[model samples]
Target: MLKTQFPLASIFFTFSLAAFSSPANARSIAIDEATRLPLVKRAQVWAQPTWIDNTFNFDDLFNPATAPLGSPDEQVLTKGTIDCTYLYEAPNGPVGANPKFKCKTTAQPSLKLKVKYGTENGEVRGEVLGTRLLWALGFFADRNFFLKTTNCFGCSENPVNQKQTDPNSATTPVSFSPSSIERKLAGSEVLKLVPQADGTTKVSQGWGFEELQMVDAPEQLRDREALKLLAVFINHLDNRKANQRLVCLDGSSPQGCTGQTVMMIHDVGSTFGG
Candidate 1:
């Protein structure tokens, strides 16, 4: 009787241990913030700032030398923030089995303005005009914001050649692009680009604009939708496509060859008429 009872007790103890050590339980515990210090640290590291120099500005679009600097923490733009990293997810497949590709996103806060030119009104106007044009055209876009700074230590000076400059160039006391530099400066947000899944990489533009050569069949319906939106934007203001894209997915393959079609329009610098 003692032997039989001992065996049953041992079995119960093993089962309890296994149940407590299951993967589901471990996953739930991992998701708890208190228990996931390592994960939080990793996320912070991944989000560290990678600066781009010499981005373009449309300060002339607003009244020059009149815009007043707003507080740094003020939220000038309002829109849903997207997890830009996911734009690079390859088609469904076993992890580590597919070829890796380079991916990038320009959706982060890219613009910083000098202290003298910073004003709430100017920031709002720039954001509204750019966002309205893209939204009217039915393309995915990012919201804009303003950053005010008193010193010119690490701020972008030029609007056009920002990506080509040395990241550690000497600091200047004025605003200057590759073309010219000025003593006082104001900054504006610029559009960003990110790499998408393989085989789904095609971009489109407004009427009279050249279509980007892509690998997959173009979705006519989505193209029409984009065109309609473009028409509305152009009618309001002469908006041109700085960047355009189309994406497709297919169910038969895991390589993004056949799936729902999607379009993106980016970078309508400034409005023409209104």
Candidate 2:
């Protein structure tokens, strides 16, 4: 119960696979404006499923917390106060942090604060646990940490758009109680082709993005497919583009240098127990 499902409209993506090409070659992608989804030709389902890479590492995330706890004024890492006035973009929407705040520190140049309250208390835990699981599985998930905080700098500021976010709305807020503060990571995982069961062959890559009206380079479709599985495992029900990003695979693909694109899972707060 960690996600909020997007509208179940039939407006999902479709693929145009009339022609075939090598797994590494760039291809064309089309979209249906009515559906707002892409058109891609899917590969025939394989019984053996030779698309996934078996190699993965989880040493950094699984480790126990050892850093000493401190308050925001004292610069304690385990916990701290967020200067919300340094606000970036508080959409005043329920898509994410009620009022996402910016944090500027020497070690963490671009950290953000996300608060969870009432029934959404599990959001913090879901985010923490989901990060570990996705990172281990070798899919793209950004860095986020769950922490407790009582201070919110901009807790009572008047909102910019009173209609999008009513002053008395339960979901929109300038400040929150001891909340779930999530620190944005410096960077995250990349998408690339994995060696097939044969050990050296490339099976699948790339997907068509209808929103862009262009089919991009090939990516081991398994990587994105695996994300679907990871979401299920973490109980992430809201896997919409609102929580995802099409990021560059960073030099990790078979080419050993950055060029192609991959679907990056940027938000996992919708996992765990939303």
lDDT of 1 by residue, 147-240 (tens): 2322233334431224233234334433311110011111111112233587343332221233322213333333333344443544434335
Which number leads on lDDT? 2
| Clash number by candidate, in order | 14, 18
Query: What is the TM-score of each predicted model, taking all chains together?
Result: 0.29, 0.45
Worst 10 residues of 2 by lDDT: 14-23
Q: What is the C-alpha lDDT profile of model 2 across 192-271, one tens digit per residue?
A: 23456776743222222232223233433333344454456567676654465444433334323233344545677767
Give the range of the ten consecutive residues with the poorest summed lDDT in model 1: 22-31
Please give the lDDT score at residue 150 for candidate 1. 27
Off by over 4 Å in 1: 1-128, 136-139, 146-152, 156-242, 247-259
Error of 2 at 16 (Å): 37
